[model samples]
Target chain A: MAQLFYAADLFGVAVFAITGALMAGRKSMDLFGVLVIAIITALGGGTLRDVILGNHPVSWIRDDTYILVASIAAVGTVVWVRLTQPIHEKGLLIADAFGLAVFTVYGTEVALQHELQLSTAVIMGVITGVAGGVMRDIICNEIPLIFKKEIYATACIAGALVFIALRALATPPWLDTGVAMLTVLATRLAAIRWHFSLPRFHLLDRD
Target chain B: MAQLFYAADLFGVAVFAITGALMAGRKSMDLFGVLVIAIITALGGGTLRDVILGNHPVSWIRDDTYILVASIAAVGTVVWVRLTQPIHEKGLLIADAFGLAVFTVYGTEVALQHELQLSTAVIMGVITGVAGGVMRDIICNEIPLIFKKEIYATACIAGALVFIALRALATPPWLDTGVAMLTVLATRLAAIRWHFSLPRFHLLDRD
Candidate 1:
């Protein structure tokens, strides 16, 4: 189970790197800029979570494998995109949905391991799921999609809530993780398919 | 000396809070939004530095005073702006400059005390100085001013370098800090006054 989770985590990192590199390409950034953005998009969320939790040395700094994987994924993205056509947008979104589900479940587990309060743990899970994409959009000078886009963060929150409830029922670890990830993936995919979004709250004042 | 530094740090927090509130006002955000942005702006850089350095509890979390000062300052700006004239843009810039200088020097000191390498210390100092503003701008969905504006980060780098150089020269603590702060302030003000800017870097490719 541990080995499977580790592999999925690396896959999530690579998926996020591809998304980041694609965004950088749109901005006409050079290869160095693309790599930097890709790495940040892949590792920024986990790094932020570990930092906030006071986990020392950060994950990537402690284990070089994470950085290596993100880098190779970014470079591979550039090569494939240049040699062929841009990745199909729908395919990219499906990949991202899976990545988000994996990270959200993994982050909740990490927070629970550190013995954080339930509410804090759920928040941390959502942050870990969405923060890398948030940072990517911010660096690219766009409002974070989570704020106004489809049910992105909401899906993460749902998954986190499910995880905590399952933990309370003392379910097996693998079953609990699998169920939570599926919850997130289903929520996100359904939102994507139905084109549904939460209503945006905006202040009403004439400029 | 410690008391003085503490007071200065709070003052810096207040300055950053005001800048954040002003930016929020420009975006026509409500009071709650303004306060959220202000708190993030005032404490974001320090929080990031502490987290990255594995300093537990974070500065604001450890000391409620930081959050209190930031909140009060943000509210004060709203009241002042609504009751009277808006703050002069130049005045706001100058206050931000001082805040940046203080944070940079303080961040460098914190990193050094943590026994980090000198180069890493310098990088931390610069990050601490400018990261809050970068975050503020990003949240507001704008390109960070440090990326293309006057010698903002350059000034921070200059101060960090000066701090390190003086430390090696065995300068007194007070002298080292005072001189470094002055260096940043002078460089930043000169840039603002002279309209000097670093050359913008852009890749040339026909779309």
Candidate 2:
């Protein structure tokens, strides 16, 4: 079970790192910039989570494995982009959804382990799922997708709430995590497919 | 002494909040958006510092006073802008410099309290001084000022290093903080006055 969890975490990291590198490429950033963005996108969310929870040393700082994985994924992305053209938008979206789902579940589990309130735990999960992408967008000088009308953060929130409810009902841990991850992945992919989005908040209409 | 420190902190918070509200005003954000940005700009740096240092509940989360001060400042900015038709650029720059100087000293003090290495402490001080503005710029979809040719972060680093040196030389605590704050303020102001800037890093020159 532990190995499976680790595998999922690594998979999420790789996907996010690739997405980060692709963004840097699109912006025509240098090699160093690409690697920095990739590392931030792969680890920024969890680092924020651990920091907020008062977890010291942070995960990547404590164990070098996460950084190693992200760096390899970033290099792979650069090579692939050079060999074949840019990755299609659809493929990137799917990969991002997978990362969001896995990171949400992992973040929730960590918060719960620290005995945070369920509401706070759910918020933490959403933060973990969305913050890295937000940071990536911010660093690239773009508005964050989550703050837009996109249904991104909503999916994470839904998954986290469901996960907490299942745990409260005494469901098996693995089953709970599985259901939550599936819920996030399905919601995100469906949103993309249907072009579903939240209504924008406009205080005043501009010309 | 504690009261003096608290007063300086609140002054910094108020100045940063006003700057945030002004940025939001420039972006034509609504009242709610203005308030949100204001609070974020006032508290984001300190929160990031605390989180990175494994200090839980964060400063603003632990004490409601900071939020109260920021809210008041944001509203004041709105009213002031409406009445005065925008603050002068020079005035805003001075206020921002004041906030940066005070926050740098405060952040260094916090890092020293944690017994961090001198270099790490200096870095933390710079982060705390500039992160809020960076976040504000990012949220407004502008490139961060610190990352540009601006001498902002450098001033913070210089001040932090000086503060650490003074402490190492057994200078009085208050004197150390005072000198450091003045150093930052003077460096920043001089840079603005002289239009001094670091060279920009351009991986590829655009046509």
TM-scores for chain A, candidates in order? 0.93, 0.94
Which pairs clash in the backbone of model 1?
A: none
Q: Worst ten-residue run, lDDT, model 2 chain A?
A: A198-207
The C-alpha RMSD in Å for every predicted model, in order, reads 6.9, 6.7
Misplaced by over 4 Å in model 2 are A30-33, A204-207, B1-43, B52-54, B60-133, B143-207
Model 1 alpha-carbon drift over 4 Å, by segment: A1-43, A52-54, A59-134, A143-207, B204-207
lDDT of 1: 0.82
How would you encode candidate 2's per-residue C-alpha lDDT over B112-144 as one tens digit per residue? 989999888998898889999888888878777
Best by lDDT: 2
Tens-digit lDDT string for candidate 2 (A27-84):
9999989999999999998988887777888888898999999999999999988998
Per-candidate TM-scores read: 0.61, 0.62
Put down candidate 1 lDDT per residue, A1-207, tens digits, no spaces. 778878878988998888777776666565545666787788888888987787888766556677678879878887887776656666657777887898899899889989899999998899888899888888888567676568888899999999999988999988899999999999999988997788877789998
Worst 10 residues of 1 chain A by lDDT: A27-36
Model 2 docking tier (incorrect/acceptable/medium/high) = incorrect
Task: Report how far residue A171 has shifted in candidate 2, in Å.
Answer: 1.5
